[model samples]
Target: MAAAARLAVAGHRVAVYERSRTHGGGVGRLAREGFAFDTGPGLLHLPAVHRDLFVKTGKRPLEQCVEMTQVDPAVRHVFADGTDVALPNASRAGVVAALDAAAGPGAGERWSDLVNRGREVWDATRRPLLEEPLREDGVERLRRDPYPGAARRGLFRRAAPRTLEAVAARELKDPRLVALLESHALAYGLDPRVAPASATVLPYMEQTFGSWYVRGGLRALAYALYERCLERRVEFFFGAEAVGVVEKDGRAAGLRLADGDTAGADLVVAGVSPGRLAALAPGATGPSAVPVPPGRVSVLLALSGARPEGTVHRTVVHGDRLAELDAVFGTGAPGTGSYRPTVTVLRPDDPTTRPDDAHEAVTLTATVAPHGRVDWADDGVAAEFAERMVRAAAAAVPGLPERVLWREVRTPAHTEAETGAEGGGVPAPVLAGAGGAYLRPANTTRMPGLYLVGGFSHPGGGLAHAGMSGALVAGLVVEGADFRGSQ
Candidate 1:
């Protein structure tokens, strides 16, 4: 969709070649019934990045398109011992107190310092790394400099620990806090032992900048983007799937579609995964795309007209179900763990995502291994996952099962098949064993006139980042822009 919009905005008459029948697949679009949801991504932060996408197309005033509220205490957590922890964005002191209650004394201060340091690195790298494109040696560059136009790779270094366990052991003291912190690593398809510490800053963005609950839903945001694209006169392809790259000699030319049709152009901007592009490439080595690891998977639930009793506008992360957590996220030392499971709830007045008091909804998500790890084609697996997730959600809001009018579920494989995201990734970089750089594909593939976008490309995933990265990659293609210096 970014490719279609940007290329069209760039005067190239663009079209999206998607495997799924919907736009924003998983995260943005829903089907089969009158119900709808931005089911995948529940939290939205970094409005600036989204603004960047709009500004380039004179859509900067996207603010007027939707009613929005910046939610405080972006997350409300229920711990194993039956304690509730609700902290707003940047409520470091409050978070610390919560930590003390759940873990031990002095934990609050300890967390405050760690979070603060992470913020420092975030401030230094957010713009360059998260916002801009990077050099081909992007990961290595971050590993080396990271502060001035470089991010602190200290959170993840070649020799440093890469899993959540290592991060917990090195920075945090308590086992429970470690679990809490490690739970976050699932965003990057990592185990606590192998996950990068820099990821710690992600939560701060919500805590500090706060998350937005747009008056309608994420699908509304997608609709807004689609409208902007239409307003810009960008070409639209509802269910077109690009079958392969159309190459002529050394310079790339256009694309071939699954429908046996060809679209000719001077440039090709692949909004799909780099590996997917590789799969379609006619060649093996040069000008070809690289591979990306599968991203984490989640079990999402949308209970028809059900809201947790004590739900707040902020995200609710139920953390007490340790047995389920192990089944989902795993207890391995980072290398052995499987997936990290999570439960997120929405508030009643979440005008953006909820319906007009017509029906209530609650979603449960768990990060699991990508693709082959789980078989969603089997109704048995999907049903089992749904039952388990519903049980978890019921803990927050009783009688939920009785009120559930419909149940919607998506696994990593479902997400991957729908969006073509690497490893079913929603834009998080994948790394654990070796070089982090190797895990990420370059903005420009081996194919000339071909580029990458979405979360899998450069800056990572999340809607805001994906929107902005689209613009950045478009500029690189249009102006021959060098991306090595991007964060």
Candidate 2:
């Protein structure tokens, strides 16, 4: 929708062919009996991305489109040892003080120091890896780790951490602190054991930019973007599934629809997974070689009690790191052993989420193996996992199991059914280093006039990265091959 709005404003006749009857592919909402819940991401990490889209595409700004507010005490962490700490939103000093109060004196400083180094990673890659299109030499350039402060081994020598887990162990030193660092990677479906040290930017981005929530849920932002697209004269063709990219004289000329109809076009932008893209444009290579990341298991609870005042909006109930990583990456058994998997509990204070003050809506999410790796369709399997999530969330929400009026469980199978992502795998954000294993496919494909957008393309997944993907595609389309990116 961001690309559509931009292209429309650029005097191009843009038509979006959607398989579903909705605009947002993965961003969806579920409302039942006057209780509403956002089925996808509950918070917006980087609002500047959407703000930039609105500024470029329309006269009305993002603030005028949706009600967005920064979440204070950004996230409360309930560690495995029962230690709780609430990190303030975008306040380094406040976070330091809070962590000191919760853990000890040096805990805050160690965390702050790591994040400070993460700023170096962010500064080095923010433009090349994000704003600009992935250049041909991008992979080689980004393969080297940019994180500063490697521990000194011998005289005039340093041992640089290669992975996020290594960075946490070498720097943070505390078990709870390690969980805090690794949880950020787990939330994005990345295994900290293997994820690049540059992945530290994940938590850095969140802490620096602060967490935000849109009133009525993040689905509201999707609606706002859809409306922006419509206002820009971008036409929408719902239920028109594009099965193939029509090639004429070695260039993308149109799309072959599912209904045996063809829609002619001068250019084609496919926002789909690499697996699906291979089927659409045969013989064309995708952008990256990274394996499909794991998906999420969400349990939406419609509770009978009201949201208590002063309750934190988001909480992270940390679980056994080794068990979770092994289960999610398929290194071990599918079921979480005696240890509980990490679960995120969200209880928004918005009145629109409930019928009245007497009731509250809560959501629990945990990263798990994709559909191909696990049978999420089995009612018993999904039920068991949901039960575990509820149990883990009890640390954050008091009497969680008892308060539930009813619960709805969504797994990778549901994601595959809804979004058509191969195996219902959620894409992780593009990161530097680790042999370019974390890089996503370039926006421009080998096929001429055929471009890729959304989570599967350059900049990878997440709300902000996907939006940036749209912007990059738009720049490539409007400014042509030589386009460097936004200034």
Q: Give the per-residue Cα lDDT of candidate 1 at 217.
A: 70
lDDT of 1 by residue, 361-468 (tens): 455665554555445556776667567656665556667778776667776666667776655655464221234542355567667777777766666666766776
User: Where is model 2 poorest over a 10-residue stretch in terms of lDDT?
Assistant: 149-158
Using TM-score as the measure, the top candidate is: 2
Q: lDDT values of the candidates?
A: 0.59, 0.91
Q: What is the C-alpha RMSD of each candidate to the true structure, in Å?
A: 5.0, 1.5
Q: Judge candidate 2 against the unseen true structure and give its global Cα lDDT, from 0 to 1.
A: 0.91
Stretches of candidate 1 exceeding 4 Å from the true structure: 3-11, 31-34, 97-105, 137-139, 144-163, 282-310, 314-340, 351-358, 421-434, 437-439, 482-487
Clash pairs, candidate 2, are 287-441
lDDT of 2 by residue, 1-487 (tens): 8889888999999999998878899999999998999989999988999999999998999999999999997999999999999999999999989999999999999899899888989999999888999986877899887877655656663566899999999999999999999999999999999899999998899999999999999999999999999999899999888899999999999999999999999999999988889889976664446576899999999999889889999999998878778889989986545559899999999999999999999999999999877888888989998999999999999998899999999999999888889778999889999888888888898889999899888899999998999999999999998899875
Off by over 4 Å in 2: 151-157, 286-288, 335-338
Every model's TM-score: 0.83, 0.98
lDDT score, candidate 1, position 277? 62
